[model samples]
Each structure stands twice: as structure tokens, then as C-alpha cells.
Target: MTGSSHFPVRGIIEGFYGLFYTAPERNDLISFIADHGFNLYIYGPKNDRQHRARWREPYPDFIMKQFAETVAHSMNRGIEFCYSIGSGVSINYASEEDFRLITSKYQAFYDIGVRHFMIMLDDIAAEFHHEEEQLMFNSYAGAHVYTANRLFHWLKSLDKSCKLSLCPTDYHGRAPFSDYIHELGKGLDQEIDIFYTGPEICSETISEQDTADFAAAVQRKPVIWDNYPVNDLAMKSEMHIGPITGRESSLPRVCKGFIVNTMSQAEASKIALLTFAEYFKNPDCYEPWPSWEKALKTIAGEESYESIKLFAENSLYSCLGYPEAALLDLLANKALFSLRSGEAASVSKDVQKLFDYLDSLDEAGYHLKYRMSNYALRNNLVPWIEIMESLAWAGRRAIAVLRALENNEDITAPLNWLKESVSEIRRHPKRYTGSILLPLIEYVESKVD
Candidate 1:
């Protein structure tokens, strides 16, 4: 039986809004989200006076005004705005200053048009073992509470209302899911309408059972910082990049809500999410989108998700400062296909271009030169090589289709390419570290051994 009813899917939204405030990127990003089907957009600009400095002071009026206009555009497009306020973002605020900063951040957002806001406390705190770090953690957690509680009080203090979503400061790197959940729940302002991640955000593995449990435990109307829409449940690399939707694990849940977090990696592939939504709304739409040409004018817009994603990958590595993330992170996410990879022929011609492109790029061992997104494909060569090796795997699949056209399946041509890739890895073992490379290495060693 299909597990379609495990979770009731909602219309879809976001908990974080990536920023490129120094230029026109932010404007482009917001418009992109609206075209796709996200109704909520959280504003988390990297650095600005409203967040980095004391709230008692004025934020540069021009930036502030422009930001408000951006929010207005979001609302006009039917998107809800969630504004983030705090100094920990820049890692430089003390308690009183954090209070001053977050308070103003929230107020500024609310004044503009935000009905939702997020308070990030656990993150600013440092290593708990260090006295100074512990002090920072405490101060940071307090400021979160100060902002959160005050937010509740402020709502009571005024007729204006909002839905407060708070994140535990130590969230990104924490374990003992229970402790994290408990601490977050204990400190949760009674007025808080939702918790950001709860216990379901996966960094290493995407387990349906775990998501089910997190939903059960967090009785509040749960809202998640859905990372599957990006890539995780493995190291922060791109081993098995697929599409942007988390269809396999998420479509069957009956819960509060979900807010996907888009980044430079997945935002460009917004169609993935829209495709996922169509399936969630009606699985037959599970069929691959016709084309970005169709999807962009219809769902994703302009370029196909494949081209947009490639552009993002090249943009990151070739242009953006954070050349550390990868495109595969966005591609290999299996949850995208309702957790199923359909027949290649079934996928749109534009969507299929990615595989064709990878198949053709020059290869050295398993590492092929991807020049699309600049330095954004920052995953270790291990994953890159694996995909390169998977060229062997991807090629095997391709052979069945190609062999009929041409006799003598000279898989050796690509196989030789694979051998060269393995040899390159052996030649530069130091370049490939960690446990990820082992499988690809062993796959090749077995050939020689």
C-alpha cells in the first residue's frame, strides 16, 4: 500500500530567507520564490545595522527603507514574511545588546509587514565547557528568551499579533535529540506559536520513522526547518544529489506545518519544490515537469530547474564567496521524486540535460571538471569522484538504451575513463580524505585485486 497518508502535506512555505542585500540578488530571490509556490519568506540578511548593532541606534535609513519595500513586495506576491533579529548572527552581541538588537529587528519587521518572526538563541552561545563560551551561551539563550518572552508580552502590551518561531541556539551542531528538544521546549515562550526544527531536522540520515517521532513528540503545531529541501542526513557534502523536494519521506505526515529552507543551492532549482507540491497535492503530477520552459512560465519559470541549478552551481564556485557548497547536494536528494527516480525518458528533455552534461564533461579518475557554478560545488572530490564513477553506473543504465543503436557495447571507453579516475585518486589519496572515498576506492581496487 502506498504510504501517502503518513503525513498530511500542506501548501508549502519557508522558515529562512537567504539574503544578498548588497545587490539585486535579494530581489531576484524573492520573485523566484513567489513564482514557485512558497507563501512564507523569512528575512535573514547576513549583516546589517538592524541586526549587528544596538537597536537603540538607527539602522541606515536607506537600507532599512529598501528592506521594507522588499518585504512589501513579498506580501504583495502573497508571501508571508518572517524577520530574524539578533547579534549572534554576526557573533558579536552581548546580552543587553542582543536584547536591544533582536527587539528592534522584530519591531522593524513587524512595522514593515511581517506577521512571523524567528528568535535564534542557542546558536550564539559557544562551547559550554569553556567558562567564557558558557557565559556567551547563557547570555545568548537569555537574550532569545528576552526577545521571545518580550514578544509575547509585547503582543499583550499591544493589539498587534504574530506567530513567533524560536530556534535553540546550540541547534546546528547538537545531539542527544532529547536534550535539545527538552531545552528548547523548556525555554519556549508560552507565547511562541511554533518551534523552528523540533527534533526532525536531519544532518546525517533522513528517516521517516524519526520524522514521525518528532511529529508525535512536539505536540505544538510543529513547523520545521526542512533541510531535505537542500541536502543533509549525510555529511554536509554532495554524495547523492538529486532533486530539491523531499517526497519519499515527507509526503505522508499529519502534523502542524513545514517550512523549507532554500539556499543558493536549491533556490535556483525551485521547480523541484513546485514539482513536489504538485505530487503532494496530487501524486500523478509526480510525473517529471514538462520543461523549465513550461515550468517557469507555469511553475518554476524561464530556465528549467536543471539549467537554473547548473547556473547556481557555477555561480557559487565561479562567482559567489561561499565556494564551499555543491550542486549535487541539490541534485541527489532522493526525496525529490516522491522518493523515487522515475524513468529517464519520463523526465523532461531539459531536466535530462544534467545527466547528459555530466556524461560528457572531461573526467580525471572520478572527478570531472564542472565549470557551471563556479566554486559552489565545494563537496570533497570523493563525492564528485563517486558521481564520476557513477558515470560508470549512470553509463551502465545508458548502455541499455544506446546499445540497440550501436553494436559492441564498448563500455570499456567509459570504463577506461573510470579506471583513470581511480588511478588519479590513488595518486592523490591525500586530496581525498574521510570515509566517503572508501567505497569508490574499493569499487576500483576490486577491479585490480
Candidate 2:
């Protein structure tokens, strides 16, 4: 399906490595995407054996029926359901039988009412496997170009309105285009869209200049395969629950829309996906924080918004970088500054306020664990909540120890509690990413010692 004015060609690609979404979850997500104005959904979970590992095989009857139903569901909602195949793992690029096998797979999906198609050659060995393929093609680029071009023509012959896209092996970088990309850019059909993930697979920012440079190298505007909020690979322990950042506003002018690589957790993914919709709809005027807060309120429900926000703020660290928790850090330092400057009496109220805030965060953690509607989010955040609660307990004990010392009362027990709480936080089983409390814990430890 082609992009229209009301809806950009933007969509979500279920392209994460672990834990494929269930059929129900996929259906729910499609509905969510339609409600939020996203126009496409690419079904390409990396772990789906048929989609990647066994790319040339047709789906079983049950699976095919589900996919057909999904395509119909998306069509009813004005969303294009793109079927993606990653056949590069074991395809004999030079063989006509291999081409026919791949074509047959696409034709099956085409019969299922899917007109949008993608061929993903990402994350495969760069070398050809068969001697015949090596002899027939000069390089890996030639193989991919030949396969993609052949498929493009075959699909066009069947239906001219069919949209085709490709994800090259060398899909990211700044300079010195790989022979694969260079050859594909020169030889591949220009009508087929190309997918790029900026300078790196999980890039910090996608700038207009960088995209323009990539477009120049590829001989076509790239459809950004944005990997924001996808915590697969080494980032599996983390959940990216923050607003999308670092992407410049003018990106749409240079690239052909984006397809967000969403997390496996469907419900939590909507938080970031909502913001992506906002950014794609009006890149020039998008404000992440406002969109983020609205998304939380809408997704988490008003009653549970504050608790979800409390958990989400701590989970904002992604491959791009940590979100600025400058205000909290500054307040924490200020409280310590008061103690060091011998102005404890003057800033006692501010210290109390900071302590209260931290305490409330601990309470919010409890609420998130027991009360939030999203079980996956709660499960993912349990470790972080434990850390936050331990830190809060430690912070309060440190304050108590300080107050005891100032008043010249017995301080041994509170000091020991502070030490134990700090130990609890440091020894927690799960390592939370981008912890804002670490610095505060360090400061408290210094003061207690």
C-alpha cells in the first residue's frame, strides 16, 4: 500500500529477536497503530522460524490462516500489512529454483491480500555459501541485487501497485560504503525502497545530513528502520519507556518515512510508538515530553498514570543514552551541599522535600508492582522497583542517622540500617539500566561512612 497525505508511510516492524507476539497481541497492536495513525505493520519477528530461519518454507495451514486474518484486519483499518521474509541465511542466489521458492512464498502472502512486501538481508553472513553463487555473482551485493530485482519484477508483473522494500546486509555506516551497498545501490531496482538504521544499528540520533549522505550512497531515499525502544540484543535487560529523542525534526524531508523496530512487550511498546506517531505526523513541531505524558495517561489510564510514570522514568535509558535526571541529581547534591556547607539548618526543608519525593517514589514502585494493568511492564520493572525501594530506605536511614548525630542521640542502629539497605540495593539480582538513584546512593554512602 502506498502512503497518502493523511498517513505517512510510517509503521512498526515486529522485528525484535526474542519473544514473538501472540496472534491476539498482534491484532491488538494493529488496532492500536490504526488508532494512533500509523499506516503499516511489518510482520517479521526475528525469532519466527518461518519468517527468517526457514524463510523459503510456506507457513502451516493454521499459521497461514492467522496471517490472512491479520491482513484482512489491517486492511479494514486502513493499515498495510507487509509480509517480510529473511531468506538470506541459506538462499542460493544464483539458482532459479531458489528464486522460484522465494517467489512462491511471496505469492502465497500476496494471495492473502498483502500487497506490501519486504526482503530483509540483515544479520546474515556477508559471504556466499554455494560455489555456483560465488561463480555467478561478483560479490554478495550482486546476489542480493539479483534476487531483489528478480522478485520486484515478478511481483510487479503480478500486480503493479505492489510495494517492495529491501533491507541490505550493510544497512548502516558513515562512509566507505561496503561493496554490497555500493553494488546494490547501482544495480538494484530504484523503485524498491531501501531500509537503513542510520550510522549504527542502534543509533543515538538520525540527522538529516546523515540520511542525505546515506541516500546519496544508496541512490535512493532510505526508509528509516528506526531501532528506538527495541531492547533486544545486549539491551534485553532494559525497557525503553521514554519519549523518542535525538532524531532531528527535518528527517522526513530527506528519507522515505520510518518503520520503528518495536519491543516484544506489546503494551509497553505503545508508549514509545505513540510518540513516534506524533513525530511522524508533524516532525517539525513534535515535542516528545508532551506526547510522552499524554501517551502515559492514555495507555496507563488516568488512575494509574502517576505510578506508571514513576516506573517509566527510571526505564528511560536506551542505547541512545540516559535521559537527563538532572533535577533530581541536583536536588540530591544540594541536600548534601547543605550538610557539607554547615548550612543544614537553612536547607533542612529542601532536604526534607527531597527525602519525601524519594519516599513517594518508593511508594509508587509498590503501586506499579501490585496495581498496574500491564503485567509485562510490572515484571520487567520489579528489579528496578526493588532498587528504588532499597535506595529510599537507605536515604531515610541516612537522614535519621544525621538527625541523631546532630541531636547527639544514639546513631548506631540507623547507621547499620543504612549500610544494610545500601547492601540490599547493590546486591539485587537484576541489574537495572540507567539508574538515577546510583549517584544518590553513593552520596548517602559517603555521608554515612
Give a tens-digit lDDT track for model 2, residues 8-90.
57889999999989998899899999987788999899999988898877889999999989999999998899999988888
The C-alpha lDDT values of all candidates are 0.44, 0.82
Model 1 whole-model lDDT (C-alpha atoms): 0.44
- lDDT per residue for candidate 1 within 361-410, as digits (tens), equals 32333222342232223332334444444443443333222332234445
- Candidate 2: where is the Cα deviation over 4 Å? 1-7, 322-324, 342-347, 373-386, 398-424, 427-436, 439-449
Model 1 alpha-carbon miss at residue 119, Å: 0.9
Evaluated against the true structure, the overall lDDT of model 2 is 0.82
* Model 2 worst lDDT run, 10 consecutive residues: 1-10
TM-score of 2: 0.89
- So what's the TM-score on candidate 1? 0.55
Candidate 2 differs from the real structure by a C-alpha RMSD in angstroms, to one decimal, of 3.2
